[model samples]
Target: MDQTLSPGAAADYIAAQENKSLLRFLTCGSVDDGKSTLIGRLLYDTKLLFEDQLATLENDSRKHGTTGADLDFALLVDGLAAEREQGITIDVAYRFFATDTRKFIVADTPGHEQYTRNMATGASNSDLAVILVDARKGILTQTRRHSYIVSLLGIRHVVLAINKIDLVDFSQSVFEEIVAAYRSFAHDFGFETLVAIPLSARFGDNVIERSPHTPWYHGPVLLEHLEAVEVVRAAASRPFRLPVQWVNRPNLDFRGFSGTIASGVVRTGDPVVVASSGVTTRVKSIVTGDGERPEAEAGEAVTLTLADEVDASRGDVIAAAAARPDFSDQFAAHLIWMHEEPLLPGRSYLVKIGTRTVGASVTEIKHKVDVNSFQRLAAKTLALNEVGVVNFATLAPVAFDPFAAVPQTGSFIVIDRISNLTVGAGMIDFGLRRATNVHWQALEVTRQSRAAMKGQQPVVLWFTGLSGAGKSTIANIVEKKLHQLGRHTTMLDGDNVRHGLNKDLGFTSSDRVENIRRVAEVSRLFVDAGLIVLVSFISPFRAERAMARELLGPGEFVEIFVDTPLAVAESRDAKGLYKRARAGEIRNFTGIDSPYERPEAPEIVLEGGTTSPEALADEVVEYLQSRGYF
Candidate 1:
């Protein structure tokens, strides 16, 4: 093959080479595991480097090489100056190369713990993961972490490359022992293919060519195995799904829904239904950038003209009419927290999947998974690099398949509404049964009937303020006065509930949101029972409070802001919590470490510092009486 060609000829030749299947793969391992070196060696042996590039590599290796008088192969892949200076990969760098049999896109991902999110980004699009293990340090924690993430991302094909074989004397027994240990631990992970290869990537042994250094190993070299591996095509036999990315209306005469087929196949005259609106139509034609096509399969970007004008727009999903994907406003999913700010339950975010984006919130966190141990640890919030099972609620129903069924439609990203930065990645486990299967059961005796029987209207009085601001005190007095007045009532004190209902939650912003959520739900139930529910908690976030209000029926929720100065609360530190928070003994404590967002408007504002608890309770009772809730 010629080393150089004219620009136009090169482009033509590359385009003509589409007959070859392309494999997208990545290399991942712990720090100093030679992932970059292995990729550098692969590129070098494949003759992909140009003469000028090689010359520069040779000169740079002399100046920056870790090994004396030997070219540092890692320099070929670690292109960033910081990476070169630190001698470690920090970002996921992608490179394109080809062998005689297949074209390849190789991702060199960082291995540091802090950069695990970057590794996950690379693994999400990869077909195979080449997980490197240092022969001398076999099966470290990070190796397990990388494998777990690859499995989570649904990469079934994995190659355990035992690099640095020279350091371990190329011992076949050592390689076998490591492989056995890994297989034992991953018995339940359900990987379709797992191949273990022992090779020295630095010396170019068993990388691109067969090396006599590992004469005991008879398996094919890395490149040979990669070229021969069968590619797993998408499931074209399943129901068709095309998430409309754009509505093509270039001219008044032609209208088409343009998007990449997420799964299955679409042909002319195929009956399709809009997932969001349930509007059914038949496909009239399939058009691509080149021209009209008879059919299109998954992974192919094409446009489809409907037989009749129907409600089809961007963010709407088109699928087979008979087997439409599940559409729901609620789902159970596995979430990987990616942002430095911990994920707060009940905080609204943008959930983006396929071409659809909608308002969403992490309604509940079921549990966090310890990647190294695979243990399900109870957690109220997910911190950076933590993985958890959670429940998500979107503002409106969105179409999706379970991740196990369709990778493209089932996966999504969580974007912070304020920053618009991607904060988490999620895979849909399944839609919540209550959200899909259960319908509201109408009762003969309704909430209004219960209120009439009690001779009063049911309502929830939500008191929110800084800690030790007399919310609980005022609430307790109000509940007592209501009880004496024969008014049906129940008081949900925040600290009292935490002793049982919210025992698993801490005082982090995420946990506080969840605490308020649980309380508001319980209060709603109480109100349904024709009781005046008093919910007193340090619900610091205004968004979560708004959500609570939205969860109730009209005029059922009332926000009573307990306005008290932070200095006044600290001075009256009943539990000594304020002193402890000021002393740094407690973290995420509102008015000390965390922020306390004041409610912009409330039905009532009582100065807890100036008024007695009894007087505040009397004021609340007067307001309730004025509202005809005697």
Candidate 2:
């Protein structure tokens, strides 16, 4: 298939290439299992490399090649200096190539356990997985781990490329044994197709052409199988979904919702509904950059002008009226934690799903999966690369479908709010029934009215500090002064509240998070009742404190940090808790074994170590008077 052609022939070839069906697949296995070499072999056999690339590869092979006196095909894709030096792929390397019949996009993913997140990213968008297994090594731990991730990400097809078969004398029995073991573990993976092929990637055997070394084996060559496999575009068969990325309005007479259709099809005069509001409308026209289109299906970006000017905005899903996605604020999902900081249940995070971002938290960890044995084990937190089934609660309802049904809407990334780094990825399973069942019962009385009756604004004064840091003492004094001044106030002490509201929670990091969460909710309720609520607690984690702040209205929550030196607080431990913590009797004691993240920017910072409790109380009262609280 020489690409050199006449002008007319070249134009025709370009057109044919554009129409060829594209396949996206990834190569994954344990380290040294030859993922990079397999992809390099594919590129070489397809003749997609230029003469300069070949010369560079040859020179680099002499410098870093593992194969003696032969070109190191792995050098072609392992472009990073560290990768070439280490002789292992660190990041995912993507390459494009084509045959006369089909076009292919292949991702050579890393195989080390530490880089599993990188591998999962590659698998997320792939339809097929080329899981290479060393013929001599059989099935290893990393092999199973990669396979589990592939299944979790909804890949349906797998090609078990048993590489280095020449090392095992191309033994048929060895191949069968490996395939049998794989099938035994992957029996429940639900793959539509699993084809096992024996190949030597370095020697180019059974990759693009048949080899005589393995005469006993009979199967389609790797390239032929890839070109013939039929991968159904699942989104095109499901219900219509278009998550509005932008609300387009350029003139007084025109308005359109622009987005890539996540699933199904849309046509002129077709009735559609907004997933958030259920506002029904018909598609007036489908507009593309090229021109107007009669219809558009999944993966096509188009602007849809509605027959009626309904309320569809960004973060809203526009879908076929007959079949709409689930709208809920809570759901169960499987999360893959990808950060050095372990995922703590009840800690706040930002969830980016579809075109929407919302404040969310993992309400519960049902269990974590052991990738090796696929066993479900109890877990309070997920470490890096660990997968867990958890329940998530969002601040607002989101429109989505189950990942198995619609991936674009179901998958999401978890971001750290302060740093804005992606810490995890998850796939939604289903909407929680309780999320839809619970409704806010409206009342004639409201917070504004209650505050007006009290003749003062409602606010929550959050006092956070180390243990024995005089938080409760200072808070009590502030509340008493406010009460004497005829301003209604209430104080919630950490030890007192735990005796009733959170008695069952322990002092672990996870329990501490839940403790603050419960207290935050109680403070919110107290604020609604028009009382200046004082919360005194050792709220160590900054993330939980930020969550509490977000729960209140602007200027309604004041964070007061009781700054005290650790030595000073420990010496003033009248409760003897510090003694027990230092003697190893108590675990997870803040300022001892646990951490206390100091407030980065609190409204007020009082030096409890140097100042008297009365003086701190007066400072708080004076600040309140200046703000017109009384």
Clashes of 2: 0
- For model 1, the superposed segments whose C-alpha errors exceed 4 Å read 1-16, 235-237, 250-254, 344-348, 362-367, 375-377, 435-437, 440-510, 518-538, 542-577, 583-588, 595-630
Per-residue lDDT of 447-549 in model 1, one digit per residue for the tens? 8889889888999999999998999999989999999999888888888999999999888777787788788778888888888899999889876787788
lDDT of 2 by residue, 379-483 (tens): 999999999999999998899999988898999999999789999999999999975556789989999899999989999999999999999999999999998
Rate residue 284 of model 1 by lDDT.
98
Which candidate should be chosen as best, given lDDT against the real structure? 2
As a whole number from 0 to 100, the lDDT of residue 413 in candidate 1 is 97
Those runs of model 2 whose alpha carbons end farther than 4 Å from true positions after fitting are 1-5
Stretch of 10 with least lDDT, candidate 2: 431-440
How close to the true structure is residue 293 of candidate 1, measured as C-alpha lDDT? 86
Error of 1 at 438 (Å): 3.7
Error of 2 at 198 (Å): 1.2
> Candidate 1: what lDDT?
0.89
Which candidate has the top score in TM-score? 2
